[model samples]
Target chain A: MSRREQAKEENRARIRASAERIIRTEGIDKLTMRRLAEDAGVSLRTPYNLFGSKTDVLIALLEGAGFDPGDALALRDEQLVMEQLFATLDHIEAFFDSDEKFYREVYGGIMSSAHPDVRSTNVERVVAMCQELMTHAAAKNELQIDTNTRELGRYLGVQLLAVLGMWGAEFLSNQESIRQVRRAWCGILLQHCSNASHRAVDAAYQSVALTGS
Target chain B: MSRREQAKEENRARIRASAERIIRTEGIDKLTMRRLAEDAGVSLRTPYNLFGSKTDVLIALLEGAGFDPGDALALRDEQLVMEQLFATLDHIEAFFDSDEKFYREVYGGIMSSAHPDVRSTNVERVVAMCQELMTHAAAKNELQIDTNTRELGRYLGVQLLAVLGMWGAEFLSNQESIRQVRRAWCGILLQHCSNASHRAVDAAYQSVALTGS
Candidate 1:
């Protein structure tokens, strides 16, 4: 990379890391622009120059964590349906590791928001990912059901989100919580497969193979 | 009721209603001793005298909203199975609606707690209720499966908890979210019923009827 670009990257990284640490210690509500800039050992204007505003910084932080800038929408189509399912679930756990409290704060805030951007953008991304997962799973005959796969997928994904929110909030953490969730998820999928009409499964698989779905 | 008992009851109701209003308007974290006193038209010392602490007041608020004192044990009994399951769930929902922000605060507090009183109490209550639900459901041959019914019951319960938390966090309006949850709960229950073997069902029904379970 060019010297100027490298310099800019270093500055942004410093800002994000410092911001993250501040959030870890003080919490999302306490993460002020001045505090972040001071924590990063830079002038207050430095953050404004780099991030524009607190919201931009938040988007940047979440983007860094694989929730923003279309990360949820970028699932690899090459993977098997089950692999995709587990991998995304893995992301839910890892996201908790990165910044647990921030996840809860953002989740609680965006979900409770009346703003159109907040509502539409967050819900659509989740619903889109669900549709993609369910459609692919159905095509592979891994998820069979008479019910709409899109809706089922959405429900499961949101369920994961909910659990993660609870975990972040600190409502769930038995030695067995994750194991329990996995079993429950497995049961849902297994039942869905069992419930699928044989003809429906056959048609879906056939259509998928021919259409590269 | 005796005069002193009646006065205590009035104070309790007054505290709960005032706390609910404050939490709804300004959010839960902002629920300071001073604000509560101002809003409730009582002395600042009154809260401490009446409930001992903010957490105690919250517990009372939840109790006032339908959390029975003996529910943790009552819901675990086989004889009261259906009443237990239904009442436990309805109380859970009532807590969500009694005051959205306070519910978030307390539920958040409960979930992330290292404190035994906070975490263990909730866990004990849930596990007891689930075990009771499963035992009854299994006895009726409603959930005959290869795995333990108690474990299955817990798994399903957590999934519902997870979903309800997100839904309560306001991804949807309260009414619609509750409706969706009830629908999903039925779907889950029906799937279990369908998968149970005939022998298991007959034995379960007999067990349930014999014990009036």
Candidate 2:
């Protein structure tokens, strides 16, 4: 990149880092442009010039920190569907648990905004991740999938997002949310699966319970 | 009530009304204590004195305008479980659709807060409403619930709230969210019910399809 472009990118990163720190320490309500500019050691107008608004800065942070399911996708060939699903959930949980404050701040920021672009992009990412998992299940014949697995994937994605939101907001504890996910996946979702898939899911659930994960 | 207490109540109502108007017209991002005070024709600190915070005012608006479900509950003896469920949903949709902007603002406010008291109260209200519906369904033997109806009620309530949040955030259209709820109630939920209940649910689904709702 050119020197000017590189400088602009560096400036943007500094602003985002400052925004993240503010949100983690002071909550989303404190993530103002003035506070962000002061923390980043930039003029007040610099934030407006770079991000346009506080919501814009938040959207930029989320887009930058968003996770990719590449590793989870890689495990599809070697693992049972339930095992793969839980592993994916664990991966997701770890990402959020790594910085609970930051996750809560980002989630709160996303939920607070009425901007359709931001909201739709977040939901779309969840749908895409679940679709990858469902695609693997269909290829392995792990589920009967009477209806379109894509649609099922969408539903599952929404359910997980709801659980994540509940957990982030402290309406449900981490363990409680994980248990809810297990019940929905095993008790409810398995109903639509093949007999073999049902057996596999049941076995997986039992194994997890025995291991106390 | 004493005259002083009556005036205090009136002043509180005016502040709330002004908050609602500001949120509906300008969105939640524009809602500040200063703006609210000016709009309400009160002192700068009046909003903080009455509601404590912006979220507190928003929560009050939601609690005030939230659906009562009293009308649907009263129809317990006159309608099938599916009929009553849909009626309750219709009531909720009407309340939301009456002013989509206001509904979105209030919902966004509720979702963004991590305050345990507010989050728990919002969820508990949903659980209580759904439990009442489930109790009526059980009393009339409309469905045979294998698990605790309260647990089932909690799941249904959470699912509905998820849909409401999605709809308010514009991630899902009204029709699409309603269809999702219908699928959950009939397709997934009925699995835990009796065969006779399954037949009833299927019949209800078909009847609704025929009516093109």
In terms of TM-score, the best-performing candidate is: 2
Q: Which candidate is the best by lDDT?
A: 2
Q: Which ten contiguous residues of candidate 1 chain A have the minimum total lDDT?
A: A204-213
Q: Per-residue alpha-carbon lDDT of model 2 for B38-61, expressed as tens digits?
A: 999999888888888777888788
How many pairs of residues collide in each model?
A: 4, 0
Among residues 3 or more apart in sequence or in different chains, the pairs in candidate 2 whose N, CA or C atoms overlap within 3 Å are none
TM per candidate comes to 0.68, 0.72
Compose the digit string of candidate 1's lDDT tens values, residues B1-213: 999989877877787788888877877667766788888888899888887767666666666776553464353544434434544555566657766656666554334333436544655566556766676766765553443666556554665556655554446544444544444444334335534343433333232121110
lDDT of 2 by residue, A1-213 (tens): 999989878889999999988887787778888999999999999889988778778868865786554455354466777577777777766776777667766766765564667557767877877767777777777767453677767766766766666675666655556655555555445455666577767764553331211
Q: Return the TM-score for chain B, candidate 2.
A: 0.80
Clash pairs detected, candidate 1:
A170-B111, A170-B112, A171-B111, B139-B204
